[model samples]
Target: MSRRDAEDLEAAPDLIAEGARVLSGADIEGARFEAKIILAHILATKPSRVVINADPLAPDSISRFRELVSKRASRVPLQYVIGTHDFMGLMLACRPGVFVPRPETEVLVETVLGSLRPGRDRPTVADVGCGSGAIAVAIAHHLPGAAVHAVDISADAVRLTAENARRLGLAQSVRVYEGHLLDPLLAAGVADELDAIVANLPYIPSGEIDGLAPEISKHEPREALDGGPDGLMYFRKLVSQIEALPPRRRLVALEVGLGQARQVARLLQSGLECSAIEMRRDHGGIERIVLGFIDSQSH
Candidate 1:
């Protein structure tokens, strides 16, 4: 078969099958299923609807679809290839190098939404290390009265988060800044007024990063995944930062890796960072979410 032969398949089923065959080499877990998803993206419809239509695709459309498949076959992430990821019901733009938000983190968002209590009519939230502003925008979208500040160290992350905020009509509610953790908020003169700091910082131990799927280890940003030698590097810094800051009812919510929740919980409770800590499990039954409330005066 010619290199371009698969692109010439006119019938939808034949075209999708050929695309699936191509995907099996590198991106294969379920190539046919993914092929249908690619079709859904091209048609701007649901995957289930891809086959029901079964309409003959135009040559240009087929070529475009196959090109996307080829990118996926090269082991590019599906979300990156599609250039969007559905997070908390919002389709946020995605790109190479920027870490993709996981669905499991939605439970972390829910944990924050249910637990955030600042005793004020309006609240301030800082989504530290906000990659694409997933948590920040979702919180601002749900809490129209909130002011969410999304801060990240990476310029690409900051730009992508800002773009997602603007696309979701949350530019006013969700502000994006390029800096590490809460420093941007402090510089913006609102650090002292913050009610919550939520983060899903890198927690994969250095030794384990290369062991992750190629889709993650090879394609995603390493700084967004590496957590130093022990995977507690960034978390420890964040806890210390909060502890050193002036005290208030500043809530902290974090997403932890498997088997690391207990140690992180201990880290939070060991100091003045968190007065009381709580853990919540994700759909995968992993202890994935942790939250803590800061005692106003350590009473």
Candidate 2:
């Protein structure tokens, strides 16, 4: 075949079509879009430009693209493969063994941001179990005067979160520590100073972790899921810790799994003696975010 004919066979559309077919066979949704995105990554070009530029992949590039497609076909999370995830309009570094930020958690962030008191400027906030620094960085980025801390049990997650904060020029604004839940903050004596605390803890029931999507059960970190028997184990633990806070009006936001919001809210209300609680639904209409406010007088 002529070189031009070879180019036609190796064009972006042809590659994406072939990839999409393979991905679809693997039961991946949005196969075409994923294929395009993978191709765009290999080509170091935008997805729209993949075809607009109509450039054929180099032989080595083709091999690399196929390798990534195979990894995805095996159910590896796309964010891990791409090395980044979009959260709150910011691209955060992601890696295997770290929790990927979900779109639903954006609602949790919005609620926290909105719930901030009018005159309480420069509030200190802690993002417990802050995987990839999504919540911590988003809060710091949006609320400039706020002090943010991101903590995680996994060293990999801590590193990724710190990297993201630095990459987004929030290294100074968002402090990251390696510890389980809020332990690091407590050690640093920042626990009582925290005006707000947000956590997207592992809420998937232990028995249900293996039943989740292959991308989650097989690829994502188990510590980032697996919430013991009733899926409220970590929430209970965090609430217990919050009880040590000094008397003050504090805002706490938590992202819970399916059908787990109400239980988590109750845990907050009773455990923290929260004066009021609010549940916010995600795009799916599931009550995914539970916010609790403990008034100073409640102490």
Off by over 4 Å in 2: 1-13
> Candidate 1 residues 124-195, lDDT tens each?
988998998899988988777899989899999999999999999999998888987777777788887788
C-alpha lDDT of candidate 2 relative to the true structure: 0.87
RMSD of candidates 1 onward, in order: 3.3, 2.5
Assess candidate 1 and give its lDDT: 0.85
Task: Give each model a TM-score.
Answer: 0.92, 0.94
Per-residue C-alpha lDDT of model 2 across residues 1-299, encoded as one tens digit per residue: 67866775566347788889989999999998998888888777777877833655566677788899988999998888777788989988888989999999899999888888476678899999988889999999998989998899989888988999899999888999999788899899888888899999999899988888999999999999989998889998998888876788888899999998888888888888888899999999999999998898763
lDDT of residue 129 for candidate 2:
92
| Candidate 1: segments with Cα more than 4 A from true spot | 1-13, 117-121
Poorest stretch of ten by lDDT in candidate 1: 3-12
Pairs of residues clashing in candidate 1: none
What C-alpha lDDT do the candidate models reach, one value each?
0.85, 0.87
